[model samples]
Target: MSRPAGPAPLLRRILQRGACAALVSGLLLVRQGRRDACSGAAPLNAISHWLWPESALRQCGLSARYTLVGAIIHWGASCFWSAIYEGHRQAGAPPPRARPPSRRPPAPASEVPSHDLVNALALSAIAAWVDLVLVPPRLSPGFERHLSDASLCRVYLAFGIGLAWGGARGRRAHRLPPGTRQLHVES
Candidate 1:
């Protein structure tokens, strides 16, 4: 009997997720910077201000501090989403219903389509849409106030691309030696 392969190593998975989040968020920041710059505005300053208004941070008396705080918030959010996606992958595909008691082999890991890039892209898109349209206004007041629709679209696209790329990279890393099982056990 074959057991489904275990998920990738915890540290590796975390790194992959973190890297994806960083890339996506960094690119989004750059995109926002470019757009704001074209309009003769200081984009970084704008991001810092948007994240924490001057009134709110007035006591702190440091705009740079607010910018750092905003960066942390944005990247933390990206890592959070990446963790969610990785959790789903680790759980593997759901078992089919109503199987008779038998010694049938477990399905091969490759047969499970959950780790594929297309699925990642689809999941990212849905997650982005839901987060942007459904969750923000209810949970995060003024979250969308500083962002335009085009900027949001770019953000989503970057996230999807980053997710797919990270998943593909992790999958490649997790491929076992031809005769090995899971991590080290031999068949």
Candidate 2:
């Protein structure tokens, strides 16, 4: 299947990923707050404190200020990831080539899932792992140190779902119409 010839516009990528990130992060924040309340733990703003330790924010009485800043940072990071996805996608686009018709039988329609969504979700999950597991230790966010394994799992789950949704939306936007020019077409 042929895809569009170039990367999507920067604005489109930003809009897709930024919106998804906002929604995911907002939900996680509310969920975390509720969990903390039920367990009678301190109210924690995980996202802000991850990038800027809660201790430091509280020391300056700037937790609220930095929360907004952290959110901007988070949304920016999401857009960055979206841009990377587009780069990989453009690079992976098949070059034009002559090919023989397939002798093998086509798989039934029911057996085929949308590859774009499958690939997006898979890649998003990988990205989430890198972000939640690998990066935290390297940076050693003080706020993250207090989080239980379950909380971290929830964070990754939310991020993965958001990434998949945004990516699939972007991919659908760029898809070529059926019966559009294929590699076999000649002028």
Candidate 3:
């Protein structure tokens, strides 16, 4: 039998990336909510200084200027990373679940992670480095302005989990029957 094509058609893959980005973006927002609970969503407002860069005070109230802009920025960033993750799969990091079943019984989830999860985490780490380290303070994610480093870690953790979960869900939804299992990924 012919091997199932990895991923999906070009158009579908693009859509999948968008879907993944949405999921990741939603997770990020959820994490942001925790910050909101502590600070009045000011973290969202802090992200953009287009209007009050010089002002010491930034107000966040779910207005178009604050939360909306932050959400959009977060979504776009998610999309960028999702595209890269999908591109890597298309470029031949064996599609997840395409690997042959392990002869030994599948290990507990905690013990083993599919390659896709590792990849997702790596991408997430890269994103954290870029957003927090490489990017200038002016360009840094606004949450940092209001959150402690511990809180930031939680946000990134949410991001990685979202990315992996989204990727896996997207893969399963598009999975075809009797696809080739020739691809071997060391779990």
Best candidate (score: TM-score): 3
Task: Point out the higher-scoring one by lDDT: 2 or 3.
Answer: 3
Off by over 4 Å in 2: 1-11, 37-46, 49-63, 95-114, 136-143, 171-187
lDDT of 3: 0.62
| Residue pairs in collision within model 1 | none
Q: Residue-wise lDDT of candidate 3 within 43-76, one digit each (tens)?
A: 6666555444633125645677666666666666
Residue-level lDDT for 104 in candidate 3: 89
Ranking by TM-score: 3, 1, 2
TM-score winner between candidates 1 and 3: 3
The per-model lDDT (C-alpha) reads 0.55, 0.54, 0.62
Best by lDDT: 3
Tens digits of per-residue lDDT, candidate 2, 1-187, equal: 4434334355676568556855684467446645643311222333455555644334222255554555565666666666666566667878757679678864442231356446555665676666657785534322344446676566556655676667555555435455652444434
Error of 1 at 8 (Å): 8.3
- Model 2 score (lDDT): 0.54
Model 2 vs. true fold: TM:
0.57
